[model samples]
Target chain A: DTAVSQTPKYLVTQMGNDKSIKCEQNLGHDTMYWYKQDSKKFLKIMFSYNNKELIINETVPNRFSPKSPDKAHLNLHINSLELGDSAVYFCASSQEASGRTDTQYFGPGTRLTVL
Target chain B: AQSVAQPEDQVNVAEGNPLTVKCTYSVSGNPYLFWYVQYPNRGLQFLLKYITGDNLVKGSYGFEAEFNKSQTSFHLKKPSALVSDSALYFCAAKTGANNLFFGTGTRLTVIP
Candidate 1:
């Protein structure tokens, strides 16, 4: 069984277009996170949700929004996608929201190409 | 503020040889360190982590890491590297806020 899964493995859209990536985890983790990996392979956390509550919000632009309908699902929606948005987005989940020892499992990532 | 650093951007090793990827961290209290690997066009996979207890922690796929508090480092090591072991390795440190800070990542290449 896939512990964490992401839909729309690839997304290509023009500037000003909007797109959304869906994520679901069967690990029964309460905390979910969205991360962006740039072309330089630099990974950075964008947002984190715990029990459907927003916990960590980085310095990301307002164009990107993350929504968690339930504890097992977290989705990312980007508005007015730009060329800079061309990168891989990863979704992860941890068993506990504040448990420092919990390991976070990641999904297969979504490659977004903004042309 | 918490941060992790991977000194080597790339490391090449021969197949069947032992390999090590260096990682250092800067955090306030006891550090919560983790190692993750990423294959081409794939998401990050948890390799191992060091929260407490033993200084040496073992993980998946014959991987292990040593946590040295004095040096503030947690380096990943493998006894015998395979060609499939080539991937991008990342070191991350978790903060008190329950957020993780990842390094720039180190690309490992195992030559046959």
Candidate 2:
């Protein structure tokens, strides 16, 4: 079974359009995270949620918002997408809030392209 | 603040030869270091981690990492590399606040 999964493997939209990417995990983990990989292959954390509670919010723009309906799901919504938003977004989950010793499993990743 | 660094942008090795990918880190307190590998068009995959125990930790696909406190380094190593092992490797360190900081990444090319 796929431990972590993401929907809309590829999203291509025009500028000013809105889009959303869905993420889910069946590893029975408590914490989920959203990460963005830019053109340079730099991976940065965008948001983190623990038990449906927002925990970490990086200095990302307000145009990007993450919502967690439950512990197993965390979705990212982009408002008025721009060309800069084109990149691969990854979903990950870990077993503990400490995250120090836990292994975070990642999904296949969703490639977002804003033209 | 916590951060991880991968000095080498790329490392090339021949099949059946040993390989090493260097990684260094800095944090306020004890660090929880991890190694992840990514293939083309795929997400990152967990390889191994070091919390607190033996300095050497082993993980999937014959990959292992050594954690050195004094040097503040966690380097990934393989005794014999396979052509299939060619991929991008990432090193990360976790802070007290549970934030994970990732290095830029090192591309490993195992030539046949």
In terms of lDDT, which candidate is strongest?
1
- Note the chain A TM-score of all models in turn: 0.95, 0.94
Error of 2 at B81 (Å): 0.5
RMSD of each: 1.2, 1.2
TM-score of each: 0.96, 0.97
Error of 2 at A47 (Å): 0.5
Which structure among the candidates has the greatest DockQ? 1
lDDT of 2 by residue, A1-115 (tens): 9999999999999999988999999998999899999988899998888964676565899999988888889999999999999999999999976656778889999999988
Candidates in order have lDDT scores of: 0.92, 0.91
lDDT of 1 at A75: 98
**Which 10-residue window of candidate 2 chain A scores lowest in summed lDDT?**
A49-58
Residue B6 alpha-carbon offset, candidate 1, angstroms: 0.3
Judged by DockQ cut-offs, is candidate 2 incorrect, acceptable, medium or high? Answer: medium
